[model samples]
Target chain A: MESWEILLQQVINGVSLGAMYALLALGFTMVYGIIELINFAHFNIFMVGSFIAMWVMQLMGFTGQSHVLYGLPLTAMLVFVLCVTMVATGVLGALIERFGLRALRGVSGTAPMITTIGLSYILFNVILLGAGADTKNYSNPMPNIRWEFGDAVLHLRELILWGVSLVLMLALHYFVRRTKMGKAMQATAQDQEAARMVGVDVDRVVIITFFIGSALAGAAGVIFGLYYNYTNFGIGYTAGLRAFTAAVLGGIGNIPGAMLGGVLIGLIESLGGQYLAVRWTDVIIFSILVLVLVFRPTGLLGRASPTKS
Target chain B: MPISDAPQTQSQRRPPLLEFNDVNTYYGELHVLKGVNYRVGDGEIVCLLGGNASGKSTTMKTILGIVRPKSGVVTYAGKPIDRLPTAERVRRGIAPVPEARRLFPRMTVLENLEMGAFTRTDTDEIEADKERVFGLFPRVKERLTQLAGTLSGGEQQMVAMGRALMARPKLLCMDEPSMGLSPAFVEQVFDIIQAINKQGTSIFMVEQNANMALSIADYGYVLQTGEVVLQGSAQSLRDNEMVQQAYLGEMKAQ
Candidate 1:
């Protein structure tokens, strides 16, 4: 491929990948924002979503067959499968808040973070034991369609991913800025006691935050599985770590910052891997994170005040 | 002015709205409130006057249940509340407008007021209380939708007081409401304090402005080194030689 063509392809690839990371980072950022704890189990929840989607599709007998419903063309029945998975994952996130995080409230910061890390490992192992170590294939295969614009090409799956992620981000922004619950979330994020003082059910708001963040991650997992057509038990740890890094880069606890950081990180990884060696991607990305932290500990947008402080 | 017209109950017979008996508090191992005792009767404005680190704020915190008193009893309405959490205390009609006017900076003035009644379940009652607060402080109404952080210091103090009133507390505890206000605003705040008391909310206030506090207080306690050294009715405390010299300025003989 020509340099310009390759660079354009890299940009497209970066954005598609970045959108997935953004979804993951949003979950990490939201949970961390209200509680000031790193929810290590979030990534595992994402993996669970992917598995759930796979199981749902298998049960529905959705094997890449197109169908017509209400005069509309449906590519695959797996859309419903993905939706169910997202909701299930959302509920799981809420359960974690109710059971795991709630008990650790007012405890030392290190204790909760360690607990989450432990839970993440436990979840990873449980999935490994149940689902086995082999990579699972989804029932809905990625459609191999490419639109050519001059010498450049756009994959259909990439276009769909970008479009859906952008819409999700916009909806999130609107929710946070406009809706009552969203405003309560912002208030809670800013000052939990103050929010509680205002008659906001602080506990309810925290749980809702977990659900929304997790749903986004779950949706991303389904999209990722559909795009790549494969999933494994151990995918969450690395992806979760990267998403967390993205969150820090954009400023942890800041909503828009998470998206921005995610996209920037994706660009760096894709472009760096293309220009240099693919294996050097993590090193380059981490080095940039180090530089950004040294210069601005707050991240690109700046850190919101942590709840306790 | 209405103080004289109200039926005079046996001058010494009314039960105290709040009573603290030999309360002791600590942060880690450092004892803050050392056997502190105080009481405020219904409709009375009691001032806890002390210089820096005399445990004025800590006293207020203990009453508000922010600082857990290790020993002794704090009773409100004849029920012990030393063990209740701060939120529960606020629910039970004890509200504190903390020092420095800890307003929610990002929230609008109206939102901050609403937060004061967080424990209230009746929407209509809360709305009515908000209107009452607005009526009490017109400035707050004027800046209802403005972010509290953008308000002037005096305005922030008004919002803080208004927020506490929204709770409809029986015993309103104010910690240094005049700490960082202008001299004019300080006078206004003190006057508001009197008006609030007249409205039937007994007040337990901590103040560094001893002279002004004593002038307005029905009863006053002078604290030094976390202990009350002198206490009496306001008029009597105002007449004592040491109080006159140290706090009240030279007495004018009739």
Candidate 2:
């Protein structure tokens, strides 16, 4: 490929990678918006989501290629894995909120946040013990096909990645803007006490927020596994940190901000890796984080905190 | 003023819309409300007047179930609500214009009103209620899309009251509605309160301004620290020498 063509291909690749981070960051920001918890365990949930998808694939007798199950194609099996893992991770997120953080509701800020770090360890251990602390190979059922735009090639996985992320983001936007429960969520996120006075089921909103955020994170995990063709217990720590950074960069608690932050981080990482060195990627990204925090503390797109009436 | 001297006796014909029987609430051993008892009859404007740290707001919270009393009972429409959650209490027709308005700052005025009707399933009725709120506060209607936080103090108060009325509650609780408003705005807020009371919603207001509160109230209770010190017809309370000296400031200091 020519230099410009290679840059274009890398840009596409960066966007695809950013879509995954945006998915995870959306969960981080949404949960933070409602409950103000950073939810360190969310990253581990994503890690577990990938492992679950891999095990589900194994159960479906998926090898390196396509297969038919009960007259259903391998694509159908992949869809099944996606649905099951999303639900499983969503339930896991709800369970964490219920048992892990519910009782600690009005406790000091550091208490619940510290509890999440501990919970992250617990989830990491569960995956490590079950999956044997080793990297597991993921099967990509999608046929190897690429569309060439001149000398730049677009992979099927990239299409799936961006398509799923955009669809989910739009669905979330619709849910939060057009629906009743979504309105209630906005009310609760702003003021829990005020929301209760207005007859919003705030406890229900909290649970729903956790479930939706975690489910999105889980979906990101599945995409990560499929796109990269590998899964491990430790992936959560690194990926979770990156996604968390994305959330903060876009403005923690801002939905569209997380998406923008994710894509920006992805592009920065990809372009930085291509131009600078792979080892310098983290340095570049963290530098952006520090600079953003120093200059625009609220974030690139986030407004200053509105004064409560 | 069409003040009722015996609202309790009249309400005895039907159960009081809300009743607090020997309620005691605490904030982690702070002992906020000590054996407090109060009631609001149907369509009555009952005011709870007290100075700062008098457990007046806590009384409102206790009724709303935001702060569960350590002992005693809170019943709404003859059903015990002490064990109910705050949202359930709201669904049971208890809505509060909490201290400082507490409007969802980022949400528009219309969205804030919509939140008030969140527990209701009747869309037609909610639509009617929105129209009713607009009728009550034309200023709020004029700024339906404006963020609640951007409104002036008086306008924010209007939105707050409008938001509560959207719940279509049997009883409306107002905590320090006049806390930060100018004298003119305070009078306007009280007028709106009385107007709302005349519309068949009972008003249970906690206020530091005993004069403004008692002037419109049919009945009044004076809370000192964590206990009810006196209860009477609003006329009697306003006339009493002790009330004038302590709260109304009708007499010059000796």
Candidate 3:
């Protein structure tokens, strides 16, 4: 690829990749913000989303041999798949919250954290057993539409992914700031005891937080399947770790900070991988994280005040 | 107002609203509440007065079940509630407005009030109680949509008190309502306390402002080094020589 074309492609790829990271990171950050639990099983939730979508698609009997849904355009089928995946994954997230996370409330910190890791392993193996160890392919009917602007080209899939992520992030911002339930969630995050004292159903708010955060991860998984065109039970770990880095890069608890941090990490990874060696990507990203922590322990944003217990 | 001179009745002989008998609490290995004993009668405004590190707050926490008593029992209305969780305590009509006005910073004043009635099941009753809280603190009504954290210190205190009142508790516990307020705000807080006491909800409060707390409190206990040093009617405690020098400040020489 030419220099200008390469730069353009990297920019597009970086944004979509950043959006995926942001989606997953939003879950990690929100769960951490509310309960102070890292929720290691969250990554497996994303992995499950892909498998759920594939299973649903197969059940629908819309084989890849034909590019139409009930004689409708292939786009509609893809949209249906996306919507179904979002709902299914959202319900799965709620179940995890109700049964898994809720059971561990008020317990010792180490126990829950370790349990989540254990849950992650269990989920990974369950997916392997159900779907087999083979990598699954999801064919996107939306062809790779490339828009050539002078010497640069932009892929349509990248644009769609970035657009959806931005919209989701913006919606999340409004929900947290504008809605009554969102405020309750923030209160619960800040101080669970205080939130309860005010009559906020801290438990309900926490469950809602898990639902929303997990749904976001699930959405990212759908988009990842569309963009990458491949899925496996183990993909969540790599993506989840990267998203975690994004969360830490932005202030962990602050919402907008997560977006900024995610995009920054994306840019570094893509640009660094292109200019420097691909092997140096992790080293560069983590080095930046260490430097940020040493200089500003609170990430880019200032430290959060300790809420009343 | 003149003191009621009516003869004692059978109802008056009933157990107090709240009773703490030799209650002890620990933080890790550090014993905070060392066998603290106290009681508050129905319709009484009782103050737990102490200096810093005297375990006044810990005693309040023990009553609310935020900190489990290592030994002894904390009973509310003759029921052992020492083992109950904080939410269950609130459901049992035991509400606490903690020190430092722990308002949900991101939530609107209205939402905070809604949270106050979390355990309440009746929508109409919850709404009525909210209106009552707004009536008590009209300023909160005006800032119904404003975030709790953005409110002024005195305003936050009002929200905290109103939030507690939403629970409609039989015994309302407050931990140092005047910790960070100005003198005028301090007086305002005490006035609200007295008003709340008059409205039939028993008040059990811990305060650093011993003189002001005793002034409004019907009964008072002086805590020193995690133990109750003295207990009596507010006026008698106010007049006690040790209390006068230690907490109430020395009287002017004639």
For each candidate in turn, the TM-score is 0.82, 0.95, 0.81
| Model 1 per-residue lDDT tens digits across residues A231-287 | 889889777777888998999888999999999888988899999989998898788
Model 2 chain B worst lDDT run, 10 consecutive residues: B1-10
Candidate 2: where is the Cα deviation over 4 Å? A66-75, B1-15, B250-254
User: DockQ for each candidate?
Assistant: 0.24, 0.69, 0.29
The per-prediction CA RMSD against the true structure, in angstroms, equals: 5.2, 3.0, 5.0
- Kindly report which residue pairs in candidate 3 clash with one another: A198-B115, A198-B116, A199-B115, A199-B116, A200-B115
- The sequence of per-residue lDDT tens digits that candidate 3 reaches over residues B1-254 is 11222234324433688888898889999988889878888888889988899998788778776689889998888889888777788888988898887887766788778778777778899889988888889899999988777788899999999989988888899999998888898888898888888889999999877788888987788888887877777887887878887776732321
What is the CA-based DockQ of model 1?
0.24
Predicted candidate 1 versus true structure: per-residue lDDT over B22-68, tens digit per residue: 99889888888889788888778899877789899889878876578
Mark the 10 consecutive residues where model 3 chain A has the least summed lDDT: A62-71
TM-score, chain B only, every model?
A: 0.91, 0.93, 0.92
**Per-model fnat list:** 0.16, 0.87, 0.28
lDDT leaderboard ranking: 2, 1, 3
Residue pairs with colliding backbones in model 1 are A198-B115
lDDT of 2: 0.87
